[model samples]
Target: MNEKVSSSIPEAEAVIDTTPDNGQEGRIIMPEAERARISKESKKEEAWYSGEPFSSWEEVEVAVNEGLLVPVADSDHYKVSANAVEGGRYLTPVAKKMLDLVAGEWSKKMKKKGEDIDSLFLIVTSMTRIVSYQDGLSKKGFPTADSSNPRKSTHLRGGTFDLAFKWLKENRSVAYKILLEVLRDLHKKEQINLIEETTIGVLHVCVNPDKAKRRSSSRRLAGTGSAKR
Candidate 1:
């Protein structure tokens, strides 16, 4: 994977690229204030990898407090514009990266299909979860296949997230094909383990935490190298 040049915020985020341009080496020139801001916000709270799943949200909180959980975001790829089933957007950093790339490809595909792409976005139904949240959903008779065991759940590991496919099917069928195409690409790359949950009408995307770790590590190394001028 190509290394990243910088960090994030939202649509205004900038990523550096050191490739030569017009016979000159590429340079990154962020305003001093912006650079400082990026440095401050980009400081990772912790370096975390998925491990034993927790039996409850309480346990999840313990790990979070210990700097063992990396927060995800509602970035450009899988946006939480509406129809959100969860409160926050949090995934393992690797999973987030995978989502951004694959989802961007999906958007392109939608445009090729002659679909209106100006304001299209996916509805995120679920992201990182705790055992208590799973239980609550189960009690409400939500259609998830046995999330009682943390180890067995990709959600707990921050390896899995869900897209509200049913919402698209009912409200935006034109984009459905694009979503599938993106999923196919992701699966082929071995970057995700996906399941089209017919019962719940959602698409689950699971990241291999180990793979994500390697990918994120490489990005950091590339960033550090590029920052050397």
Candidate 2:
């Protein structure tokens, strides 16, 4: 530990002694302001560029096989055709909302910029996965799969999903800018966790399940009340 003498303790005798007999209780005494600053620095939030970390990949696979994960295609927020990509198509409700919010915001921003937006389609790069499937992908040296653990991936639990930048770009340079803006907005609101794999050109995001469920319930109640009126 680099001990810098604080301005509050000018005298050499007042310096925090590094005597071995003092034990763990021998901590430096500083002004209340300095103490608060140290406390704040220690409790700072983690950088927003990484998704939720998981342990015990086996448990995640169990959740997937038990049919606990919900399908994203069932949600109204996203558009899926009969030719949707195989696998990774399913996601938890919360993840679905995160995708929807981003897509919706992206569309709105494009429209505001006076760009034609009708031809664009939001692509779902990866979704729910099983342990075996993830393992196979990892063995093939897939970039996204390499970052995910077969047993611990949020994909297995339908809690996470990925979107490729190419699909969003669709030949438009501003697509990624819109994506970043949407991510910033959602993350600020604590609605989703996001990580941009710049090398792979993919955006990996996960929504908070608790927040999604509560919002869904509130929407339902509001709809019912409106109907009664």
Candidate 3:
């Protein structure tokens, strides 16, 4: 197949081999082993900072602090905001740690993709924060659409941040692999959950509290949606 750009040959190439197989007379087959190796190596060599062997967000922060990580926003970009996305506001000490880690991962990932890491924007949601269950709702089933409560409010009671994936897609394809990679990473940590609302296009992640409290009397009545609930 043709390459996506005029760069290196993509591993998905179907090269025509003319080497005659001594055992098969006139029959010839492509080097399947070599092809498979290329495919495997490409994944190991994928261009994303987080995919790097030893990279982390701390390293990326050095670059950010040195007046880097500031690139122009695309016309379609809508991630910039006053609170979380712009000034990095309302972040607790613990939330900052997770933000650092997340930023480092994004930095390395962008480096791998041969993309500029400086240009990405952050939102308050990027910081992991506490999500408040509705005053009376639980996880088993959320309040019906007709219920008095339409949306459960989230706050940074201690630590947790929601990340805006929609912001990343402003100028890029919504299906960009990097965004999905970050999402899966957070999900694995069990520190984050994808929001149920399609319109939000964000990830909800929070730091695990050292000493968390649970209100069972109110929690069990409603199915617990959060890990602590």
Highest-scoring model, TM-score: 1
RMSD of each: 19.1, 19.5, 19.9
**Candidate 1: clashing residue pairs, number:** 1
Best model number under lDDT:
1
The count of backbone overlaps in candidate 2 is 3
Candidate 1 regions exceeding 4 Å error are 1-50, 55-68, 81-88, 145-151, 211-229
- What is candidate 3's CA lDDT for residue 146? 20
TM-scores of all candidate predictions against the true structure:
0.60, 0.55, 0.41
Q: Report the alpha-carbon TM-score of model 1 versus the true structure.
A: 0.60
Residue 220 alpha-carbon offset, candidate 3, angstroms = 20
- Please write out the lDDT profile of model 2 over residues 67-171, one tens digit for every residue: 444456632223443333355566555565577777888878867876655544445556766657766554543333223333444454566666656434434
lDDT of 3 by residue, 1-229 (tens): 1112221112101111112334754433334453343234222111111111112334334433543222222122123233333322333343445556565666566567676434343343333112233222223222111223212222213233555544345444422356567656765554443332223344444443221232112221112333432
User: For model 1, what is the alpha-carbon lDDT of residue 90?
Assistant: 60
Give the poorly placed runs of model 3, Cα more than 4 Å off: 1-80, 83-88, 125-156, 174-176, 210-229
In model 3, what is the error at residue 214, expressed in angstroms? 18
lDDT of each: 0.51, 0.48, 0.35
